[model samples]
Target: MNVNKNLLNFLKSQPTSYFAGFNRGIEKEALRIHASGKLATSQHPKGLGSALTHDYITTDYAESLVEFITPVEQNAQTSIQQLLDLHKFAYQNQGEELLWPMSMPCFVGSEDDIEIAKYGTSNIGKMKTLYRQGLKNRYGSYMQAISGVHFNFSFPDSFWQAWASSQGKVANQSSIDEGYLAILRNLKRNLWLLAYLFGASPALCSSFLNGKSTPYPMQKIGKGTLYLPYATALRLSDLGYTNKAQAALNIRYNQLDDYIAGLRHAIRMPSADFASISAKPGDYQQLNQNVLQIENEYYSPVRPKRVTESGEKPTDALERAGIQYIELRALDIDPFNPAGMSVEQVRFLDLLITWCALTDSPDIEREDESIIAENLQQVILYGRKPDLLLEKNSKPIALTQWSTQILAELDDLAKIFDGDTQGVYHQALMAQQAKIENPDLTPSGKIMSHLLEHNLDNGSFGLQLAKQYRNESFERDFHHFTQTQLEQESKDSELRQQSIENADELDFDTFLTQYFGSSLSD
Candidate 1:
């Protein structure tokens, strides 16, 4: 009868069968293209979007891999294991080529293959390689795949504050959007700890442009630059809506336009909050630039928000207001694995989210941008390293201890899920702890170890990719797979358009204005 009781009841009543883990299946079509030496590449100066569409959306690549290879129901498990299977199948069957979009021209294989310049390595290295190659060949980029799974629980609207307070403190704002924003912000902050969770290759490269010899710090982002793939994680909020239907509707009915107006209306005096007012678009751009310039000039290290050319407008500003979900950009589509992810890993991640939801620490604040940046950098560069410092209770604490505690909380959450054994999350946490004990399992260590083991001079990652390109099954399977997917896309698009038509026929605007007193974001 009480709010908290009702909320818990709602959460309990809802099905817990939501997609919790991801499994990717690679289509034979992608493999066939890789097997042939004619994979496409991108050489775009501004960005790679014009160069590679497939590389932009890894989901398409994953779907292609699973085509005809597995039955529809069996393949659609929405678990990380599926993603791994697809990648393993592609790598084993298809020939590996260092193509554009999926990879960058880096020294990847054995230490012996060091003839090539080792520049441009990001979490996005594989994707960049595929795109770059796709540009040159005019065929298509090699694909990196991804599958996403969400563990969602909802409460009745009235009990949001009770739920928030249960986690420790009430939010500054008690609205649904504010609650979502708080959760998302916490997720983003925690993800900064990814490099510590699962190691990535080390950052070892001279200047990307000049190839000048310099000792670069072993951080996610080095001097004058940060990894763009990491940057992409921040951009996840740009898409605006929760689902494709809502996103499409917003785009169609100019819902965002009205929303923007509503926000402006709510701001009683914009001039009071800011230094100046701007009627012209150019003025607004300049004002944004000025803010960023000031922040960079005064601050020692910034989290690298978007920048613009002298004439270009600030495109990523709206996202700062907070209507986005956290995107996991650090995870790569492992070329060696068939599924893009593992079930254990997904379960572990779910546990992490649950911990975030249940933990009652008011450590994060929107105003504390500086601390957020510092925390993110610390995690990416020195995550899980015993010596690295993390701020807790406004004092420095060893990262290892913090991680251990956080992971312990996750272990408890896994018990609450009752889906898999507790061992699943605990194993990963222990493995990570062991790395802190040993320090060799870090991303940098893995990169170096891979090169040494292969006995190659250079291009260890690149060479591994090249091996995947030439697999026989890849060639045969991918060709058929992509064709089928393209056809499927056409059908889906047609169906989507029909749904749009049906929705459009209704007077949603009138219904909302009369019944709800506000227009939906689309």
Candidate 2:
């Protein structure tokens, strides 16, 4: 792949004012654990606000798996501060419970012991819980508990306008959506680079493989830990949150309509396997017998997103307003960072994502999709291996050589990004370059080293880190939001959730019918 010099030059010609207003939001997930290193069997913390209606706090998959969300901000620094404040508020409210610091889960007991997240008595609330139950039935609860970070990003309208002008085209929603889809395609093709650079979950508790055949060769760290020596992110491997049923879907993203059509087809199409689970009125094990319960369930490395209106589905929202932003889902929780990500990491992402958007992105054929997956899998499993190779257009490429090329391109982008303080972007790029040269500097490598040095199992090592974070969180002052504001938000969210419950006019089945009906019509 070669750099698209024309696109790069066009972007470079834009004034620095065009670079303003890069919006970002973060959703960071962490499991709540007990002092004994067991998964916490606790309710959602009261202080953090309602899990369903809160803007900044929620639960994912399980009640104990806490997810902190940040409101969209123009810069990474403010976004990170919001995340830290959320952590502070959550820590204060969660008594005797610590947030598990890694993407891989800590010690888990029997599958039955893991509790599903509960919402109040509204029909929609019941629907949320039932969907999770369905997920538990489809994929085990342990896999659902594996946590990660989602980075939501979008370039400013000014930048898009500049881009359109450069192309001698009108700046319209359709063109913007087309450009974003192109960026999505490019990101999907090159996501393996990110996996190798930032992946942190190379090791996991031995119990994660319980009652199943091991997927790959594993080395024992202690009595209760298993790890791959060169693995970058086991959390992204077949071992975590993977659905074999989805693998056969062959979804495409070259265009918005095609993408929406594929999603609609899957949701409307019935699945015999899920049908067997049951969908009776009171015995609703899942949302429907369809391949997807909701649009959110479709797992992908990246997704185009738009904020939905009242009673609008995610797909409907996208169709209405085009892509407002793209969410990157492949980032693992940075165990070393208290907030799961850093401002420097955010800057690096901004550069890479902008590069992806500005570069030439050809439509990916069905056959080539498998090649992309293979490349990602190779990096996830053996990224640290010096001799490891990755596939580019079905041809072998040295991992280091390809990475060097990317970094060199990034150097040019960095200069364009921060000509005033050239050191800022270059510093981040060099830090990543250091990680490429020295695998020990990588998060997974550091995790492995810590485990070995302390002579602790994965569970023990994670627990220690969680305890350390707990103390640090307590010591740190709130950065962006105050405790009073958090408390008020919690109360307000409770009232909002009740209001939603009160406003429900249709029966659950009737609501589902209307929902899928509108989706299919589109």
Candidate 3:
């Protein structure tokens, strides 16, 4: 695979300067489990701070499923260290409750056992809860309890400006937005590569199947474990967070305006399926009868985002100000890492995303969109299969052959980053290559081996890992933030939530109308 000459030249021109200031934030979700390895039914721990307003810690779908968010940082090491600090803080406050270590839940009893996360009396709080309620109604609570990690990333303005200048274009928001969208489109087309290399959730508890029949041949490993021998990242598959309604959505990432329009249309168009459920404020099963209650409900492998102002919806923020960052939502929690992710993984992402941005990307046609989806589904379900093939440019290509080509390109990009440092980027590239050569080296492969070696089900293996992580978290020192700082942030977040609740002036209906109203700037 020949490297893009223009991209290489541009990087070579700024050997020490490129990608030095890129920003990144991490959001890691984990289900809280009891000492007995059952899902915890307890409310959000008070010591963790307000779920509605906490900047660092909050509940994702269930009250027992905690999401630890880190502030944006310029370096991967710093961002990862901050996340570790958050885990340490959460472990301290969680008492006997342990954070489930894997992407899949430990031991769920019944659908009703998963408690919806609660916010206080604020209308906004109620709205958040209702959204989760809708998800539970649409997709089961078991699926919602499946936790993962989100990586939010953005190139620095200086880097964008330089790239625009090289392309004989002005370094403005429009150009930057276009560049980001192109990267996103290319990322979508090649996301299967990421899944093949990093996908971790190969096997899950049989409870996850929920008595529904699946087409895949599932072998029972232990008491209740169901798995495909070569499957990788089942969490990214339909078995994870999925919606039948979203499968019909033909959203495209080739253009920013079209992307926003697609989301806006989904939120406004009423869904016959969701319409059956009541939308009355207190009786609301969902936020509304629309295909999407809010823009956030649209599940995608990637999303372009801008930090929103007070009372501004996500779409409104993106329209008012162009894209500020991109969020990669397909990453599964690495059961091997107590922090749910590794700095090496973050470094690999930086290289891949940067490559996406620099490479020339053609606009995806409507027909090709289906191909992209198909390719992704193939990798998610059967990526590690020895003889698996994937469609690239509407032609069949062996998965290994395609992956090998992409990795070779990444190897070139990594050298640019490994300029003076300790070859971190190159090492990450080689590590990924090793996974392609040896399937057992992948996280999902390791998980399967662990299950077979221990003679345990997926749930049992995950529970033991959770216990191990909990012990490790308790013993780890605070790397980035102090306990005092975390405690203060908790208090401050609670106060902030109180202020929002006190300032509520509109009825719930009015607030929803304004939020979903026709106020999109562009």
Candidate 4:
């Protein structure tokens, strides 16, 4: 079948190193005693905790990575299977129901166990209920059950080429060939899912409620939870909208590169940006005040109400297209390696994108809201469970069986790709099968087993992962940055002199006025 090549090339052109935080190079630290390791704090550990701790960087990357897998599953069967597999795995890794230190609903505990219960099975619910009841009975609070896992995988591009270039691949005259196009399509679907997932934060939702969870304004929508869209910004209490407006101001005509970099830097909240903040042992309040100040000035968003339709705004390419890309925040750094993903995983993502592009997407405005809720619940709760029901179609099917069929269809689409006839969709299929044949082999299950074996605390997983990755990134990045600066000092002449001149002429007031003043000012 013909594919959208422009989108395909755009996806291919994305920097491969962008999502490396998922694989290896995180710092080794003593795991927290009672925390889940994924949360900002461990006070409340049963539900929504894992979802809350994800930082913006991981969320954004995850959302974008999905675009790669979306195209591969053009065949309806492949699409469904890929979706189901992801849902199953995500929930399995994250859906545990113990107190902050002891719960782990996702792990089956042993590789030898037979007939793993389906996600929606009574047993699954039982564990969640236990966690909830345990909390209410013990602490007078209730928690929600959850389904979703955070997975990280990357393969070399060779596997992608093999699949896209396989014999009998279809021919296309588009800027990008059929094979590459297929990969892009898969990525699109991933983008959607990741967006929805990252957006599914209760804290974010709470912001929409004006910081109050009124019983009437928000009826306990249903048993299912909400999943937000990717790249959607939240409104902070102090800052109606955010530095996004400043982001808009920074981008002057003829300065697109510097503008974009500046915006990223401002919003990223690096330590260098707060160099003046002190570390006095007794100045906790002062430290927090400084952090919050920075947050409001650089990290917060401008209220949508304040955003006039005609005003210039900071928009990435995707947002400009009326489609906000997903931000995947739930990925776990693989304990094993420096590279978070392998080429095979990337090819699989390509296949996924193809499926999203080729398959039918529900009309956002026309479709029932309940469809999204049901879809998320079913997928998260019962992924890979035999004879699972699709919320939209209300069809019952076996997830693994469905996944296999999807791969077969994806293989057919592989013919349209450029060179070799082999496909990456097959690898995804094999990976799924491996998990099914040996549930213990699944990444989530392994993580749980290891946690239990090591007696590591819960709630600490996410934070630990973040710290390690951050440390690794800082080590590598700082060294390279220092080297680059050194190199620039030796080679540059005119640019450096110009920079000095510009520094002398810098107008602090002008910078502030441009950033904080009204866009329509005379």
Which residue pairs show collisions in model 3? Answer: none
Which regions in candidate 4 have their CA more than 4 angstroms from the true location?
1-312, 316-336, 366-369, 377-389, 396-398, 414-425, 436-439, 453-455, 458-513, 516-522
For residues 170-228, write the lDDT of model 4, one tens digit per residue.
Answer: 32222122332233333322332322212112212222232334322222221211112
Where is the poorest 10-residue window by lDDT in model 2? 513-522
Question: 43-151 in candidate 2: lDDT tens per residue?
Answer: 9998877899998899998999999999988867888889889988888999888999999988887877679998887777877898999888877788898999999
Please give the lDDT score at residue 128 for candidate 1. Answer: 31
Model 4: how far residue 511 lies from native, Å: 4.7
What is each predicted model's overall lDDT from 0 to 1? Answer: 0.35, 0.85, 0.85, 0.30
* Positional deviation of residue 61's Cα in model 4 after best superposition, in angstroms: 14
Give candidate 2's error at residue 326 in angstroms: 0.3
TM-score of 3: 0.96
- List runs of model 1 lying over 4 Å from the truth: 1-39, 42-174, 204-209, 212-326, 330-340, 361-367, 384-386, 419-437, 442-444, 452-458, 469-486, 490-522
Better of 1 and 4 by lDDT: 1
Off by over 4 Å in 3: 1-4, 420-422, 519-522
Q: What is the lDDT for 393 in model 3? A: 67
Could you give candidate 1's per-residue lDDT for residues 321-403 as a string of tens digits? Answer: 32222223344322333332344555555556445444432434434545655665566545534577877656887876777
User: Alpha-carbon error at 293 in model 2, in Å?
Assistant: 1.4
TM-score, each model?
A: 0.50, 0.97, 0.96, 0.37
Model 2: how far residue 12 lies from native, Å: 3.0
